[model samples]
Target: MKKSSMKNRLRPLLLTAVSLTVAVAVSACGPADEGAVSAKPTAAGVEPSTGRPTTPQTSPSSSASSRTTASRSPTSARTTSTSTPTPKQAIVKNTAAPRTRAAWPRVTFARLTFEIPPGWTLTTYGSDACVQPVHRAGLPTMFDCAGIAIKSGSIAGNELRSYEARQPGGWYAATDVQPCPVRPTLADGSFNGITSGTSSPPVESGLRPVGSRKAAYDRWTAACTSGYRFSPQAWHLPVSRVLFLDYTGHAETARVLESVRFPG
Candidate 1:
């Protein structure tokens, strides 16, 4: 019975050795890139892992793997981003217009509009009410000025026009625009008689035109301490003549004149 028992133990060990040898041999013949066979340890030239070769998903363009093993079909994780919205702005429409105003005394002298000094009177140099515009002799040619008719009361432009038409060009010596100095301020620092004082009324502004500007530009200065240099566009009408009244004078008066605007 002891001898039979020894035989039995030896037979079991032999059977175990045979089984392990066959399993290893079968695994060596299978696809190496598939499954975990590549991880099985071996001695010498034993077959590598059966898992398919795996590739690093470094970039979409890369197709090669680091080693032969089971391959993992690349799982692409693609994500997209959205944009943000912007705010709206409010707009205002400009529908209002600027207003133009007319100042008083829109008075006429030598067929020009000008500011008259308060408490002052004007008189004509000639006996005929319809004589030509003449000025005091010995004054600068560019400083042309006429003694306007302001007897008893200021003459209405309409009333004067009617009376003037009795003669040619509305006056015995009908005159066109004269080259008056811009302001009464003289270059030689002389005012003949021009002087200034406070408590005197503020200067009223005037506007005039300079035409197409082909005429000679004779710029000169004289004494009109209270007056200013002025210019304007001239438009002659059948019954009315257009003359721009521009002049430069004292500092304060010049400031007011700058506000006058020209039309297109």
Candidate 2:
């Protein structure tokens, strides 16, 4: 009976040892199984235990895209800076003094001499004469060209013409009344029947000094159908038949008239 009891106690010890062995085996396998689970692939971006999104692994294309974005940042900044506009500068006006008399140049035409502003030129077409800026084109070579006696019709200058049969009446005598001399049509250079109508009465008429001699001064306005209304001024010396005509509204006209000189 004692032997049977001792066998029962040893049986209990063996059972306990078996239980410990099984527990040891299970503990060792637990770590290996957990490591296997960790090594295995999970669905795309999600974690196995948390079921939450995990950090994405970088790929070649994604790294290239990041590099591309970084490269374009400087270009975008440069474009934005260049698009801004700059302010405009202010304009300046010209304000200077007039030129003096000694600075003027002398010009001789026909038998009379006159002083013109520097850089002025005198051109003669037969008995007719024109005084204008040096840059102006030469006058037409004809006895009576169009706009020859009107300020608006010609360039800003002076015109001098000798007495002729076809010439307008106001050329020699201030009392001689005439029609507007500017022809109606520019296509034909010849004079047409007084299409521009009669001239307005003399605005001013009297004797004016011209160098050593006195001249008959007359100023009148004339109009033409070609949309030109011009003033015709004349200084006529009856003895010399020297007619000085100024058609332009030039500021130098008064100075030019005052500078006219005649020989005794």
Candidate 3:
């Protein structure tokens, strides 16, 4: 009986030991450790439970910020440009006005005309054989039956006389035309009337006679008295239809003779 009582005491001790082992296992496997802290939920692109960071979420503001930074980069900076130039021109100037001259007077007679200095008289007479009056120094106030006159003018204080006459068969009438105290005639019977055999004294060279006529210079002497005498120089030009004659005491006579012309 003592042995049976000892056995019951040992069995109660074994049950107590088994119950303490089960409690220890339950405590170890059921819940986490009390010293460790649990993580909270996080944003997108992050470990939610662990609360560790990942790639950040792309927001509208951040995208705009990136574009702004790209625009301000060194390769995209602003710069300046160049331009072109212009040209020049030339300049001119004008200084003074032009000069003019007065018109010379025209003297016309006997189907002919010529130019003379201004304010000169030209008197025509058809009364006696178509006489044209002229005046010269140391000579009579003469008459040209078939001629014209360029009277005294202020240019030289002188007068120049010219004649043009129509004759039969190209004959020259010295008395009716420009009379000389000593007259001359050609041997060719072209001029039948005159005082003596003709002498062909040459006129100044290059003095073309009026029209197609040839030039002749006739020098003559008149004996009015010892106190009054005159030597005259006459230039004659005989053409097909008319004979031209001139008398002038001035050196400008050739210039005056060259100005003669026939009327149409």
Candidate 4:
């Protein structure tokens, strides 16, 4: 009976030992299985049996496309530089002035041709002709010819006297030379005594430069019935039958009269 009890105790210890050895064997095998799993190829186009990584082959078109995409990406992200411009200025210049024009054309009456300046108009009365300034609206009508006056019509007393004073050539000696029907003689014996004396006669009375030759001229005062006073200063040439008379004593009239001449 003691021998049987000893065998039972040894059997229990043997069973415990066998179980511990099995647990140690399983833990040791777990690391080796994990290493095998890691060694297997996982990348595309790789052989799992060989366990070696494969080099993927590329097409020419795919390589070109990848290069183009990389180039275009940098263009979209990059920035370009800009610059500013300046403006210009303006300029100016200079020039000259204008000129003055001359007077009107020459005029002729009977054998007398002369320049009447720019400001006079000519009119005809029957066979007689005369010129008057534009400013003179109403004035005595002066005639150019004494015979033309008698043939055409009788001249006014004021106009007749003016005509006589202007005609130093003694061209006209009509019986109707008297200005007034009954007039006062301006030159009495006393004035004649002063004039006849060799004391230098009036400078304007004898020959002086006029038109194209020596001309006779004199100053005289007339009494008008209208109560207005006037001194008809005049220059006359007997040889050329030309006369310039200014009864109103206007400076412009004198200028025009001085400019009168026979045109070539």
Candidate 5:
């Protein structure tokens, strides 16, 4: 009887201990099962519950913020830029008015045209043309005419008859046959009928434009007796068979030359 009672009491204590162990095991496994169910594999191959790769799940607002940052990245911003580049401008030529005196009269020689001061006379002797100030006497003979003259066509009996003639030939070429002053001395346009023993070298010698054509230009100074002086400027266009001369040595000479042009 004593042995039976001892066995029965030990059995109850053992059963109670086993029941506690089973309950503790069930509690521990309960959490694991819940976690496994919640961490089911997602379409992106990431565990949503535990986040095994540690990639934080982005909320709606956070996802939008990320997208906005990507749009403003340097590469993306450059591609989306709408600013336009300025175009280069073209070079333009100067179109200012011609340098000339106002209210001056216009004169035409062959195709060449230019301006002259008022009261200047224009006369033609055969094929030669002459221009002189109104203060001068009657027009001089073809050979003796003072002031500006243009010799063209057959210059009768002069070595300058040949339009193609070059220097040293009297009345026949682009250069002066005699050196003269660049300005005149006599108010009446008269000089002592004698030339001084000295003549100056050409003051300017080159190709100059007259109207639309280029002419050989020559200017020189000539000294006459009684302290008188005369400057002779010449413009010869061989192609047009025209020769222009200025002997007045007046200040308007340069202005007149500058005013030269061609009529269409």
Candidate 6:
């Protein structure tokens, strides 16, 4: 009977131990499939694959495309760098000044011919052919050097007798004159008694334009021989080729100006 009681006790304990082990095994294995499913979808970014989830080769195609893009960037940059060019800029320069003529024409008296430049005015002498024309009217007079009158026409001269000393035009006498003993250096520069004196020493004469081509001035003086005459006879001719003809208290400056003599 004791042996039968002991066997009954051992059987109850074994049943209790078997129940605890079964509870432990169920707890350990619970929801393992759910965990695997949730983790697979998170890694894929879209949905879990029906095939192998552990494969590492899914993103290689995108990586290869990125490498190709990076490789082409250097070549594109070089092409852009080689295309542009710099243009040469032109330099600005200064303007030059106007030039002046150094020398002009000088000819002997016998060969001189009448040639007038443009803009020269024509004037009449007294009773003769001597004509007067004024150019560069503002120039200083040869004798006075002071600002002379800028007359394109007539004026009076220094008086010698009772006759009117007024000249017809601003320059040159056109009158037929009697030869007085005075020299070509008019007035002989001798003021004492202009009455009856010998001729003056020959010197250059004539009133020329300041920058005229004729080159030199003709100078002379005039006086009466008898003192009874109304007009003075002695006269001065500064230059013959180019001349300043003075008559009736007027003086005319005649000069030849031309670039080239047209063979007439």
TM-score, every prediction: 0.24, 0.42, 0.31, 0.36, 0.45, 0.22
True-vs-predicted CA distance for residue 49, candidate 5, Å: 88
Supply the global lDDT for candidate 1.
Answer: 0.32
Q: Every model's Cα RMSD, please? A: 15.9, 13.3, 23.2, 21.7, 10.3, 17.3
Alpha-carbon deviation at 56 in model 3, angstroms: 99
What lDDT is reached at residue 27 by model 5?
92
Q: What tens digits encode model 2's per-residue C-alpha lDDT throughout 22-51?
A: 999989887557778668675467666567
lDDT of 4 by residue, 38-116 (tens): 6655544655445555455456788789889999876666632223334556555445555665666677564555555
Expressed as tens digits, the lDDT of each residue in 108-147 for candidate 5 is: 7666677877988777666767777767654322245556
lDDT of 3 by residue, 1-264 (tens): 999999998999999999999999998889776555334323455554345554455577887898788877644444222222344565666655666655656665545565555434455333112212243233333234213223211111111223322111112223343333222233453432323212222223233465334554444433321223333344444442333333224443454466667555
Model 6 per-residue lDDT tens digits across residues 1-264? 999999998998999999999999999988768767655534245544576654443466876797788999998898888766667798877667768754433322223333333443333333212222345354322222111112211222222211111222212222333343233134555332234212332233343343324333323343454342212222222233222333223222223323213223
If both were scored by lDDT, which would come out higher, candidate 1 or candidate 6?
6
Clashes of each: 40, 1, 0, 0, 9, 27
Stronger candidate by lDDT (1 vs 2):
2
Q: TM-score: which candidate is best?
A: 5
The 10 consecutive residues of candidate 1 with the worst lDDT sum are: 164-173
Clashes of 3: 0
Off by over 4 Å in 5: 1-101, 137-146, 155-166, 169-191, 196-203
**C-alpha lDDT values of all predictions:** 0.32, 0.58, 0.41, 0.46, 0.61, 0.37
List candidate 6 segments past 4 Å from native.
1-58, 80-134, 142-264
